[model samples]
Target: MKKEFLANLAEILEVKETDITPDMKLGEKVWDSLALLAVAAAFDSIYDKVIPVKTIGKCNTVQELLDLVEEDD
Candidate 1:
């Protein structure tokens, strides 16, 4: 799950998978609407759940986003 997420994020950010780390700030990766959409899509496809934009906006770091994905809700 983690690996697939990293791959998704890598493609979304157009960066190498090694470049991502839990502590990395989404701001540093230029977090934008497109990235948000991509993340939402990934969650929808991977977990078959739709992540709210509001909840997603609350994530400031990669780990937070990862945690959001793992959440039961």
Candidate 2:
């Protein structure tokens, strides 16, 4: 599951697979609002759950998003 989430994030961020780490911040790079929306959409599509935008904002790292997704499960 973690691997899948990381892969999705890497795709969204347009970064190399090896660049994405649990400690990396999704918003740290130049990703704009559209990227975030795409990420949220990806989360819903893959996990069958809606992660509120506010929740995403509170997540500073990939691990935080993973925790949120796991908690939803």
Which ranges in model 1 have alpha carbons more than 4 Å from their true place?
none
Model-by-model lDDT, in order? Answer: 0.84, 0.81
Candidate 2 lDDT over residue span 18-71, tens digit each:
898999876776467777687789879988779887777777888998887888
Q: Model 2: runs farther than 4 Å from truth?
A: none
User: Model 1 over residues 1-73: C-alpha lDDT tens digits?
Assistant: 7777777788878999999888899999868988888788878987787989778878999989889877896
The number of clashing residue pairs in model 1 is 0
Q: Residue 19 lDDT in model 1?
A: 90
* TM-score for each predicted model, relative to the true structure: 0.87, 0.86
Give one clash count per candidate, in the order shown.
0, 0
**Which residue pairs show backbone clashes in model 2?**
none
TM-score of the candidate numbered 1? 0.87
